[model samples]
Target: MLIGEVARRSGVSARMLRHYESLGLVVPSGRTVGGYREYAETDIQRIFHVESLRTLGLSLRQIGQVLDDPGFAPSALIGDLIRETERRLAREQELLKRLRAVDASGPTAWEGVLRITELLRGLGSPSAARRQQAVLAAEADVPAPVLAEAALAEADPHVAGALRWALARAGEDVVAALAPGLESPDADVRRRAVQVLADLPGDEAAEALTSALADLDPQVRAHAAIALGARGSAEAVPVLVAMIIDGVNDVDAAEVLGALASDPGRADAIKRALTAELADPAAPGPARLRLVQALAELPGPIALPMLRALVSDEDRTVARTAAALAGVIETQDGV
Candidate 1:
């Protein structure tokens, strides 16, 4: 059985399972490729037996010797139990006296209680401390996969968020890699699901992008738009342009789509995106400015009319960006 299954079945935490193995009380049946311990049916039985002996106060060494010799005496275990009871009784008495003194004296005599309380609350118990180490080893970013292997960890928010961002930037073909995870039933698994589908290029990624665009989460849609742009899909161009046009209030989507026109082959598409915005009389000033800049990057006589008109644009930033592009195009021509 896997360690998780073993832990579930045995009512012992996985930590104790390895601890038992280390003490030579139980042996692992095998190991996973990641070196995770695997155990057999017999390992559980051995653990149950060892736990019984421990409750009866067998020292670990005593247990080991007993395992090798069926004739081992039970008197040694009885003596160990007696000693443990005496030590516990002494400590209990000491703590009880201190508790009584503190209770009778009141807060003035107990200034250290507040500090002790904070320390106790803030401190990590030894068992709880191992959780951080386990998370570090399991999280993808510590050894984050390149290309398309980024994935979420349920327990670590830092790892989950980082892995999602990495997958978001993992290039156009990354969508194909996330195909299986998109259908995953787990919510944590669902978080990084959309990035994979949206990164696929062309019309192939459009339906996925459309679905992401319609998702309830804005981040999901924003990432979808980014993936669509990365895929550089012409089909996505119109949808992306429309979204940018309607999304003037959307800073992130605007930023992602604006970056697209800066790409070489998409210059005309950016020009078209801008022209579409310019034609919309209700367009926001900021959105129009973004459109004007996108056009400028793809500067040509095709946008000369729009440029000349934008030179007199009501928004100063729009005119400024339009003028800059016309100057650059003119300068390039002169070159």
Candidate 2:
């Protein structure tokens, strides 16, 4: 077959076939009487081999070595090709994601597009400060969904705070965007989602947070409790009480519980729960101590009786602390 026939049959352009010939990658079996290139069956087979190797991302030079060197082991080359393909795939996926984010933003002008692009770059920057600045500098044109996605993946505390702040201001759009994150199998992502959702206002955000209270991850549940407690939701009472008992962010949990207890009904409930936990003999000594400290935040009517009973207890630290709280309670009560 002639070169033209090979090009037509193999789908390799004539120019590319000529280039391959110039590079000595594929030589025709012979020449016609007119000095035209003539490709035999073996040359066509070699062309297919070159095309197959090219599909694996081999450079022309590498392809030359692969085709010429009998001792060339494809193992190392194949490994490198795999890594290069993976890197290319990653880049393509990232680009696709950015494009999707930009499309979701609905930018009407080049300026909006540029701004969103810059913000996306900043959010992905290596420097936490840049990430923070990106979030702080986010404008109305920046998509809330973009910020919501960034917040879920952010690891730096400051950057995450900034992202949450940005998302919170975006309103319910952000709440909707964050809803999927709550269902993430990753505990950290779920916790981050709850953290952001807690700061968001509206019944939608509240519903999400209320649902998060039942999250399988303890961290997610704790965050939901704190957020709901701060929002004065009585449903948070049990989790807040549990956090106090478990001594995880107990001080902050106690403070939130105290705030929730400002309502007369909640105050009574909080008092009862604390007292119940205190009276459980299976409760460790340290846990009891934490509960005692937590009770000090309650109204004197509820806490004084518990403190008085604890004052003469066998544990001297508990007795001393209880005595001191009782003294303060008595002073406040004008006793």
Q: How far is each candidate from the true structure, as Cα RMSD in Å?
A: 21.5, 3.0
Q: How far in Å is the alpha carbon of 52 misplaced in model 2?
A: 1.6
Candidate 2 deviant stretches above 4 angstroms: 31-38, 124-130, 155-158, 183-188, 215-218, 267-269, 311-316
Error of 2 at 49 (Å): 1.8
**Candidate 1 TM-score, C-alpha based:** 0.40
- TM-score of predicted structure 2: 0.84
The pairs that clash in candidate 1 are 175-196
Instruction: Tell me each candidate's TM-score.
Output: 0.40, 0.84
Candidate 1, residues 1-335: lDDT per residue as tens digits?
88889888878888987887888778888888999888877877877887787777677787777776889887877787799899999989756744543343243534544433222232222433443333333322222222233342233445444445555554444556555555555544544666545433456556656666655554565566666665554445655565555553245444555566566677676666667678677888866766675554343555556677788777788888888787787777763
Worst 10 contiguous positions by lDDT, candidate 1? 138-147
Can you write out model 2's per-residue Cα lDDT over 210-312, one digit (the tens) per residue?
Answer: 9998888878999999999988899999888889888888998988987877789788788888888878889888988998898788767777888999988
